[model samples]
Target chain A: GIQVEQSPPDLILQEGANSTLRCNFSDSVNNLQWFHQNPWGQLINLFYIPSGTKQNGRLSATTVATERYSLLYISSSQTTDSGVYFCAVPKDGGSQGNLIFGKGTKLSVKP
Target chain B: SQTIHQWPATLVQPVGSPLSLECTVEGTSNPNLYWYRQAAGRGLQLLFYSVGIGQISSEVPQNLSASRPQDRQFILSSKKLLLSDSGFYLCAWRTGTITNYGYTFGSGTRLTVV
Candidate 1:
């Protein structure tokens, strides 16, 4: 089983500010994903980055598999972005589809 | 395009009462289904996952159980609920392969037990 840990369990930012969230895994992973859990409890998939970097609008993610870590960047944050951001990796690092999730980084964007 | 649906956006159940949560996936067949729970201010915990009909794998040991009676249906059930079971339960679906795609979660069901 791989251990996933997130940094800065709690964060607060002003609207239009930028923030970075990190996820560290204890072992190598074949699957890694970033998700945003909105206020209404809807988990939206942000990115699926096993390695390398990817960008989606104001949000982007980079995964360094060799270093066993990943970073999620949110630029020009908005009130709607106030929620919990979670990064997950496969429990077995295989094709089991069992995801091991981090505690998450709770972000609060004040307007 | 595939979509996942979960029932009863919220629920309040008495201790020792039975519980059943249903999740269905549309526009896809033979997809992998999963059940996860998140306690207050806690992270998502994987409870169960199914690769196909009647194939389920439990991740944690608890009073909770899951069943996949159909290709696209996953059910979470408890014979008797416990107060500790109160949390946000989410259902998710992914393709058979674990690579190249992210898992899509449902809106989630907030359950409060008294």
Candidate 2:
């Protein structure tokens, strides 16, 4: 079993502010993903980055697989961004889709 | 484009009552299906995963069970619900490929056992 930890368990930011969330895993992973659980409890996939950096509009993610850490950046945060951001690393194997999820970074974007 | 549909956005069941949650995926074949429970202050815990019909792998020992009667249909059931079973339950799906495509999660069902 691998351990995944997320930093800044809670965060409160003003709208238009920028923020960074970090995720650290105990072991090497072949599958790494970022998810946003909205206020309505819907889990939306943000990124699937096992390694390297990727940007999706105002949101970006960077995963340093060698260091077993990943960083998620949100620019110009908005009230709609207030929710739980989760980092998941699934077990690496053929036909194995068990994702080990972090407790998550609870972000509160105040308007 | 794949989509996952989970039923009953919210539920309030009596303790010791039976429980059944259903999840179905569209636009994919033989996709991997999973059931996860997110408790308060606790992260999402993998409860079950199935690679194919009637093939299920339990991740944790709990009062719940899962069944994959069809390739794209997954069901989570419990004979006797407990107060501890109250939480947000999510159903997700992933392709069989080992890389590239990301997983898709459903809207989730919030279960409250009274």
> For each candidate, what TM-score against the reference?
0.97, 0.96
Residue B8 displacement in candidate 2 (angstroms): 1.2
lDDT of 1 at A23: 99
Which residues of candidate 2, in runs, are more than 4 Å off? Answer: A92-95
Q: Please list the C-alpha lDDT of all candidates, in the order they appear.
A: 0.92, 0.91
In terms of lDDT, model 1 sits at 0.92
The best candidate by lDDT is: 1
B29-73 per-residue lDDT for model 1 (tens digits): 899889999999868999999989999999999999999999999
True contacts kept of each: 0.90, 0.93
True contacts kept of 2: 0.93
* lDDT tens readout by residue for model 1, A12-103: 99999999999999999888989999888899889989999999999999999999999999999999999999999988755767889999
